[model samples]
Target: MTPAELGIGIVGLGSIGTTHARALRQVDGVEVRAVSGGAPGTAAECGWPGAVRLTPEDVLSHPGVDVVAVCSPTASHAALGAAAVEAGRHVVVEKPLATTVAEARRLAELQHERGRLVTMVAQRRYEPDYAYLKELAVGGRLGELRLATTHVHWLRDDAYYAAAPWRASMTGGGGSLMNQGVHNVDLLRWLCGPVEEVTAQYATLGHGIEAEDTTVATLRFASGALGLVSTSTATPPGAPATVALHTSAGAVELGQGEVLRWNLPGVPPPPPDEAVASGAADPAAIGVAGHARMWREVVAAIRSGGGHDADAVDAVETVRLLCAIYEAARSGARVRPGELR
Candidate 1:
């Protein structure tokens, strides 16, 4: 390894972890030094023949590991992330941050205490199509956001869940919203603004899983914009997830990787990005370019001592919103994200 290379230690070797390893290969100046927690021989299967295999604890303490990527189950994210930051290693955790708002908040607090960088993987923020949309929406080119709606109607077969049982458990973050729709939820809030309140209803209409296979929610943005979110792993013959925005100026809708519709005046839309692929039918179909881009920016931030695109605090807020949706569904009340303890 070169002296300039940043060493990465992965805490899980499951699908997402393997994906991380593959994506990191596309990033310059970083190497997967070690990994822990997956079936035996998983490292070689992931094409990481040189990555040292060790226990999670050992991986954290390894002298060669400068960054720890926590790709474990949701229930383990809080503890693993805290341990990595406390060990003086920068961290990159997968989305939703944690299973609960309290856990996510505590991790964010610990990140502040340690002064170590902790970034959550919200890779859609790095996709060219979504990045362009964010510029237009956040830059006010869309003008005064009015309404935002996103739908994540994706299908997951019994075999898919059978392969990873955690994908079907609430504590494990196996729900449709947490597992599949989280990026879109994060994107919605990022593009529009904070969600002031949510009223939601969810059910396990299709799957036999403990968590809901389908969920629907109404959001009141702090910007006074109303929004709708519908996610389902039960929907068959799944189509690409979509985020449609209506503003004072006009309206635009984003497909998985391209702009589905554009009606805004005085502003030309970006050319379609054909490289983008949707995980609507198959999770593995989600390409690695976005993840590669995210890692590049994160590595740059770690080297420059600057901030990440999605920091721990920002990630906590997304979890806060997610918790509020569940809470609202249970209580039949208009729950605010901040009201979660």
Candidate 2:
């Protein structure tokens, strides 16, 4: 390996971990140095036959591992990410940060104290359409935001839950909101600004899971914009998740991969980027373009001492928003994300 090449060790070689490994192929100067926690020979099975399979602990301590990608279950994200940082490795964690706001906050604090680069996997932020949308919204091209909404109406069969018991438990960060809906939540919050309060209701309408399969919430953004969020694994024949932005100037809407509507009069919409893919109907169908883009940019940032698009600290806030929604549902009262921790 070249001296400048960065070494990556991945924990949890499941679909997500394997996804990370494959995404790294599009990144330059990075190689899978070690991995642990999945079916035996996952590294080879994922096409990285050269990567050594090791214990989770061994992967963290591997001399070649300059960075650790914590693709494990959501419940393990905080602990593994913290341990990796403590081991003097930059870390990457999947979304929602942790099962609770407290854990997410603690992990963020530890990352700061350790002075390591930690990024959360909210890959949708890297999508060409989504990225351009953010640019336009933040640039004020969308005019003063009046309302922003997102819906992640997707389905998960019993087999999906059976394949991973943890996915059905709250402690494991299961449920549609956290597991499948977080990326949309992240996008919603990113576009609409901080949420001042939330009122929500949730129920387990499908798949006898321990966590709610459906949740609906109304948000009040600090910008005085009203927002709506609906997520469900109970919905049949899932379709692409969508987000719409309404402003004084006009309105715009985008599905997971395609633009649904672009009403801004003088502002032309972004050119269609055919590379986008969605896991609306089938989780396995999620494309790697977003992950690959994120990996490339993150590696470049690490090399140049620049900042990453998805900061661990910001991701913690996203978790706080989710926590607030759940709290509102349980208490039947408006909850503020800022007041979470």
Candidate 3:
């Protein structure tokens, strides 16, 4: 079928769900066939004219829906994703594909066996500077990978969590690390390669919630490189996420989603547009450009009827990484990535 025939059906009308719908709507050939608001006929109640697929199964089974975008909460991902795949629909998960690594792997394997397109949202990969950094490392111009660091120190007030019922628990909500910093976790693995082990420490110093408000973890990459990841919702004045890559030859730093510094030998400086993306302090502050960029990749995969670049085939490792950090924080012992998978 042509790209114009690719109809998108989104489940979960939350912020991410809204973001995906808006992004898909902006595309030329794609159509928003229907949306499920996690209830019966809520899609039509919300004025969705295509089809009122109030339940996820309804959307997945709808004849008009060609791709199923799972924008639901963390806990619902594996089951919902499995349902979409079982129904033979293309699947796109928001982020942190599944709460646990094992479920994530299982879901991806099922999609693979079914020959369906499936991907996890890692929007930051659309940033040109990030691509430049990865290109440098792959070209061996950045020399050996030495150290990698990512910081997501942002604040979310009580109202932010209150507005969304799934913001702080292991079920729907997760601490700063799982919910907010999972993107950076994906970036750490994508840019720095696999993580062998992780040691972590965290506490609920800032919020009155059940999860940690602050979290810091040290990583040992399989490539013999050391890494650090810091994410928190406790900082009074939230700061934009930052990432730094140190190699044997030089270093590259990205502050607020832009390249603050690049000093590798022989490689030319990144283009100016590389810094266009930035993380906002508020949850609703996300820019649609990144979402649009990532969605375009999904659309392209649908058009080709084949491969996908951002497939969550390896996303299980990132989830495993976060789980290890949480386990290490609780048990106070360095943990391997697969311990809690």
Candidate 4:
């Protein structure tokens, strides 16, 4: 009700949407004023009982809504964000900002022209280990990055795919890399830089689904750093995902939320990090604390009349990379970035 408050309109009532609602509602001076997602009864049970349930358009056009959070599926993210941003509402997208580079770029330009706050949810950026790695990469503590390798192997049963129809297609979700491995995708790009080219192979593997369950790709960074990627949801008894960055000095390995290995001699790594719950095995298992922290940052950014970290323009690059990866795999050729337009 106060001028300091930000009324939020959240789209999608699935796990991530509920996660956002619960956390945003807890933040001071922020209200989950309205939501447009899931079925009415189901959405109500998730969170924000008092908030109005409206269609996405109505939610964005609503006067009380100061911001729109696109917690919807990957396919709906760009469309929802575009609508919200065009309506002059601040925006937040969950991940893969958009499926295509042009869509992401469009939102970025609109954000600039409209003078609105916009951010994408590459939540791993908020994770301590990844954040620390980012600091090292940016601060030159790890020296010039030569290569970054990642392995995101997880298991998802038939029922899991059945429950969420999106995971099985390119529309709602892309596949293992985009669905399960996207967080790591953002982290890799964030720690490394923009990717210039990618050569990849994608397959359905064992899952009875249309979307890919396994994929491998090699990346050429604009910074001249090359990287390797391996992702799948078919690995049995799935373990924590790992990313190893080989710099000129040494290598930095990141697991789930802990520093698996940090052997840079000149720059001493921090103390051992306690293992943190990674929503790797279970999407809903990731604690709401991270969302709470992100919301606080968003609220601050809004009040400051600026934008949050990983704004659409910044985060759109990640989506562009995702597109490149998929394209490379589909064509069985080395694909260059920005070629997905």
Candidate 5:
């Protein structure tokens, strides 16, 4: 099919939905044909000329919408995705896939049974430094990875959490680790391999919400590599969010869109100032332009009868790991991956 022939529908007109819509407008062979949400003023703000404003159900059932992008709240992801798959439309859902592993697994099974494409938005993996890190780790440059540590200390004020009631609720969405740090977690798993077990501690440090604001977890990967993940919304502004890896051969540090250091044992560490900057590496320029790239991949998969890169099953694994972490924290005992709800 030609570029003009591809029709797209965007569900949820929030910040994330806006990002996907804008990216779709820039991608070749795709059109942002419709948007569905109850957000006041979203129709005007989204700026899709001649775009249909309808309920999510209406959007999914629209004949013009060949691809459905679900950017709605985490709680609604499963329902929306199932609807799209039932309608035989290709789907791209934002992270977590669903609020629970069971829901995510169901979506995966349904999509598979219906022969439809379903993908999770894992944009961070497309970043140059991260892609390179995955390459190095998979190539054994890290030499049987001994340890990995991920820290996300970014600040999100009370106002930010209060922007939407669902921001800090386990039912509506989740806390810092699930909502914000899940991307890092997904990247960690993507680069290091699958998680075997988890033990965690969680607290509501600065927020009045029911969900956790700070979380620290220890992970055991199937490859026998150990990992430490620390994330919180309680940090002061300007604190750097980073992930560092300590392997048998050396260490690597990732901070704010750059590889801060790539040190090999006995080899002098590279100058910190000379580390590659992430902001300078635009995914768009490289033809992996964020959500647009995801859309393109979905289109290709549909046409070629191939599977999506971040399919629902893959996302369920991430969600399972997260659930295990939360459960372990609450019980004060190590949680195995298979034990997650």
Candidate 6:
């Protein structure tokens, strides 16, 4: 189908949804035909030219909308996705796919049965440095990977939680690991491989919420690689997002954006400043743009009649691993991915 003829509907007008709408508008072959959200005037704020305000159900059922982008709350993803699929529209859902494993799996199955693309928004995958790291890992440059670690530390004040009550309650999709750390978790699995087992510890240190503000997990991968993940919403401002890999060949440290250091057999580490500058690479380092690139890949996938770049089926594994982490922390015992369901 031609880009100009693609009709897209956005199902949420939150901060992320607005970003998605803007990205869609920027894409050559897509048009933001409609928008639905609980917020007042969200559709107008989304900046879509000819966007009509409607309910999610209305957006999905609208004959003019060929693609549905589900950017609603984490808890509502599954129901909205199912609704879009039933309407015979391709779906792009934001992260966490769903709040639970069962819901994510059901959505994946339904999408498969309908022969429609159901994709998850793993926008980090489009980041240049992350993309490069994925290439290196998949290329086996991290020979016989033995250990991997990812740290995501960012600040979220009490007011931040107060802004959205659901942001701090487990029942409402709260928790640092599930909400803020999900991207890192997904990235870990994507770079390292499937996690076979998980043991985690969670704590509520700063925020007075039912959900945890800090979490640490130890992972055992299917390939015998060991992994560690730590995430917190209480860090000071400007904390670096870091991921490191240790293999037989040596180690590679990814800090900020660029590759900080590579002590591999053949690749020598660049100078310190060069390493820092390179490691501090932004998600749009190469100018492909983050969400835009992701959308482009999804559009290409749809045109080719194949799976999305970030397929819902592959995302289920990440959700499974995330649930395992929560379970392990609560049960005070190691949990396996298979046992998550």
Q: State which candidate has the highest lDDT.
A: 1
For candidate 1, the 10 contiguous residues with the lowest summed lDDT are 39-48
Root-mean-square deviation of Cα positions for candidate 4 versus the true structure, in angstroms: 2.2
Worst 10 residues of 4 by lDDT: 270-279
Say which candidate scores most in TM-score.
Answer: 2
Better of 5 and 6 by lDDT: 6
Model 2, 196-248: lDDT tens digits are: 99999999997888999999999999999999999999999998999999999
Which has the better TM-score: candidate 1, or candidate 2? 2
Using alpha carbons, what is the TM-score of model 2? 0.97
Question: What is candidate 3's CA lDDT for residue 98?
Answer: 86
Query: Across residues 305-326, which tens digit of lDDT does each residue of candidate 6 receive?
Result: 9777578898888889888988
lDDT of 5 by residue, 307-337 (tens): 8768887888888888888889999998997
**How many clashing pairs per prediction, in order?**
0, 0, 0, 0, 2, 8
Badly placed stretches (over 4 Å) of model 2 are 1-3
lDDT of 1 by residue, 1-341 (tens): 34489989999987789889889989999889899978778877766778899999999999999999999887788899989999999999988688898889888898889988998899988878789888887677998889999999999999998888888898788899888989999999888889999999999998888998899999999989999999999899999999999999999998977888999998898787776789998998888888889999999999989987699989988898888888898899999998887
| Pairs with steric clashes in candidate 2 | none
Q: Give the CA lDDT, 0 to 100, for residue 40 in model 3.
A: 52
lDDT of 6 at 325: 89
Off by over 4 Å in 4: 1-3, 39-47, 271-275
Ranking by TM-score: 2, 1, 4, 3, 6, 5
Error of 2 at 35 (Å): 0.9
Candidate 6, pairs of clashing residues: 3-29, 257-279, 257-280, 257-281, 258-278, 258-279, 258-280, 258-281
Residues 193-237 of candidate 3 have per-residue lDDT tens digits of: 888889999998887788787899999998999999999998868
TM, every model = 0.97, 0.97, 0.92, 0.93, 0.89, 0.91
- lDDT minimum window of 10 residues, candidate 3: 38-47
